[model samples]
Target: MTSAQKPLHSAFGPQTTAQEALAGRDLRGKVAIVTGGHGGIGLETTRVLSNAGATVIVGARDINKAQDKLSTMKNVEVIHLDLADPKSIDQFAADILKSNRALDILINNAGVANPPVIKDARGFDTHFATNHLGHFQLTARLWEALIKSGNSRVITLSSISHMLGPIDLSDLNFTKRPYDKDISYGESKTACSLFAVELDKRGKEHGIRAFAVNPGAILTGLTRHLTDEELAAWGVRRGENSEFISPEGFKSAEQGAATSIWCAVSPLLEGKGGVYCENCDIAAIVPADSKLMTGVREWAIDQTAAEMLWTVSEDLLHIGSIPGLSK
Candidate 1:
């Protein structure tokens, strides 16, 4: 069910690496796509899935860089995808659809954070447009391909920072209200969580299940724009020389990728969808006023908010009600 947000006490924890998450699984014959797959947590996810014999399609804004980085990997394809551009999204999805292959997994793992206010071609907030709307459109466009697989999993990365969200659909692009970077980023992540909620609700009957993942505090490219001081302030600490940490410390990129990989492949989650997962397990729900950076906030998992966000997203994209995305 979409609202089963309780933890299953999986053996895995915050310290699990992407490789560890898929330790005994064989993904041969499976196909997966990872946005920003050439770098950081996404890279780890792509590597593990490909190593397990799954074909990995990596969506990167910088095609050359992505190709170069992934050139040596087996069964990996790099495609140009500028999330802030609707045209690029259409082309990406069209390209995939043209293949006539069922897409088994889709990790909407690419996103922008902490940048100066920037807008897309349609004057939408770059954070909201690229992070939320772009992935939303891409998923919608690829709905047919996903449903082709008898059972498909869609993993969208949310954040603990979503505690600040319940996005103001009224001012999504900051057209009416003042724009604050953290708030805007939070809103985008919040939007991502809600998207999973509604998408799982609508797609489950079709053998497609969606989940939102909170990948813990990993220092990845998403935080590149942040300074050391900002990192400290945000509580995303990292050791100078470690890519794995004890459960008590911050996450490494590999560790951060675990929950996403788990969401995509773990059999334990086969019958579950729409829950917010963290530390490679379904997280508990917390009150709106909570301060701890664990568990999902009530607003982020509210069914009403999810439904409203879906409609607002469809309206903003001007895509209207479509087959897989309609409420």
Candidate 2:
């Protein structure tokens, strides 16, 4: 009866693209929601799903930008959603509930990377609050709709950075520890992946499966926080003299969106959930190799950690008693 007890599966590999991932799939009458669907990987995801006949709702903070990008899409609607604000999430969920009870897919894609250190209304660290807790609350609020949809899935946008950090429950807000922005973002993303596992364990019987996806390295607004020098130092940037790009390289926005679309609409994943995915396939459980910044870490994918983080988060957010998820 809890998400901690479910099995998981994998899909394709990182080289797969959105078009390739959804080839031969049909979403004719399904309803899906993609957060931050106006730009980068999110935009490509919106485009692919909408093209496949799914009525996609673009959850964005900037209504104008969302509409501008999705202007030509027939069934796409841009809705204002600021994840940092619980009131906004509640209002959006209420509107969705009134409009339709069956939501086939929910993509927790919108996230703030390393925005200049700021605090949200909840007085939590900006990255942790917006990236993890915000989506956590949103998913909880939308649980009813997901269950009503039958065989629905929630795909969370986690990252390889999750392997680098763990949930600092005591100092989640970074109020006491030395503020390391990258670690803060990593912690939040790790929580995102764990949350998916926990959700699948708890809601699988209700036909709600959850998956966490890492889009791999893509040059997008999400990386705007890191300066050119920092990126070069990290070996993520390319030299001007380089000829053919590396196979294991940074993906384009469309490529970055591939795994997300696959997880959202791929038939290959039916009845399989609660796994961390990348490159359009279920990433293998590799050893914690610092060289390869991929694959799910033990802690991030651990059911015990997932449940503990869930309970702590619920209490922090003042949500309901998270029954079986406590440490």
Candidate 3:
């Protein structure tokens, strides 16, 4: 279904923390898979979910680091997954399915930002491959498990940057146009938002719902590739005597994860799907001139674009229609 892009007047806002979002909820017995759950907001997402008694499986590129960081957490496990590699994506999905666990929540949270222009072994743009295509393939492979859960949610982490660029379907890999880091990142995020739109449409009848979230700008390792000058340009800073800091209005890692956890378990969103959310509420759709950093862009939630992306993704991944989903 298409997104109306209307606000839900949620009780939570930008200041809400992950712990706060899950305060009254109990996830005891639920099974969740969080991609890139070893660091930043992903780690916080893992912590809070597991704290709430869910069995969280973290998909990490560095299993040792994930294991080390999660050592103190009970009911959490880490598995190897490199979203940039298709083989790795497939294997991770296979292994998870082999566990005979019904997947209750799938958070597509791991992503790269503004890396040097490069392509995967399959020649797809690195940002697109890791941020969107990988999750698409993973979700497709895990369709059965998600269906088995009876009521499941797939949360795809998008960004406000999705407003900055349009998807260049003709040359999605940047084979012809000069590569622009921000634009490439924007396109990938837009793809993520649209993926949620189409995924919800196709899976809703089977009791699966998907949402795309714009976790407000948080100081995370996702910004590791940005240089000092770039950070300065964005008004962020780091002190020789202190820790890295973000500009005013940026959320803390826990705060950044708030919306993700909200979308994953909020009863308010029970019957809704395909909308873009932020600050723990459904975001409004705004025009290009409204705001540079807030609200959902029309293209990001367009039904037509979502459908096109689903077809293109299927062709790119060489998959036919989803098992129980019709074309």
Candidate 4:
């Protein structure tokens, strides 16, 4: 049930703001969960969704900070969720399930930048654990609520960096090969896209469509790990006054959040799922040799690889069978 990896020639572009994406839509009664939705583009995402009448739940590790940051935002509440900790993820899912709410949208958005070779409790790479596995487990745990909606959308934020490489199923945590931050980051994002591939295959039958989003690079906490020199390489120069000299393709936080919500609500995507999207359109599959910054790589959408990753992820989380999805 994978959708075609081709653009819709959409009216939206890289510059579309989150606010503008939801301009004419009314989302009253829709319940959405946005992990790490209290900061940067996630904040803007939460803001836009809340403004449009959705009851938004933000899952954050720092309860107080998240609560404080989202204090003024209406139709929103912060819940404790630390993606790195399996216990925390389980509890977060349990809390939501208690409400018996039908989750209309689930944005697997909380992620950490590549900061060396950090690992979770199970010694899995943080990038793989937090960015992919955590979300995978969370989504699986919330399967009941999602299917209850009968038309839920799960949007995972992948990145164009996925073009750098695909996941190495043999050694995902750098246990065998040397650790490279760029490769680690790229592979994790690739996993994000692949999650959509597999999830859509399994869940679309139950009306749970999945999408992978590339929210064009925007300055946020995700870049805090990089040094000034590293930032400069990306064309992000800060003056003595701390003003920005941004790169040509650099996006504002608002603009970066546009495609995410668009994937959540756009009528154009009603029957579509399982495609990697960029700039508010379904991205084309580029040649593996492509040096281009846009479009998805064939490996990222490889259905076989996606199914394997899903199995590996279930084993990693020790959450064996996905009731209706498992063979």
TM-score of each model, paired residue for residue: 0.94, 0.90, 0.97, 0.97
lDDT of 3 by residue, 222-246 (tens): 8878888989988988888646876
lDDT of 1 by residue, 189-213 (tens): 9999999999999999989999999
Instruction: Give the TM-score (vs. native) of candidate 2.
Output: 0.90
Per-candidate clashes come to: 0, 8, 0, 0
Clashes of 1: 0
Using TM-score as the yardstick, the better of models 1 and 4 is 4
Error of 4 at 84 (Å): 0.5
- Write model 4 residue lDDT over 248-311, tens digit each, in one string: 8889999999999999999988988999998888988888989988989988999999999999
In candidate 4, residue 30 scores what lDDT?
A: 98
CA error at residue 300 for candidate 3, angstroms? 0.3
Off by over 4 Å in 4: 1-3, 241-244
Better of 1 and 4 by lDDT: 4
Model 4 global lDDT (CA atoms, 0 to 1)? 0.91
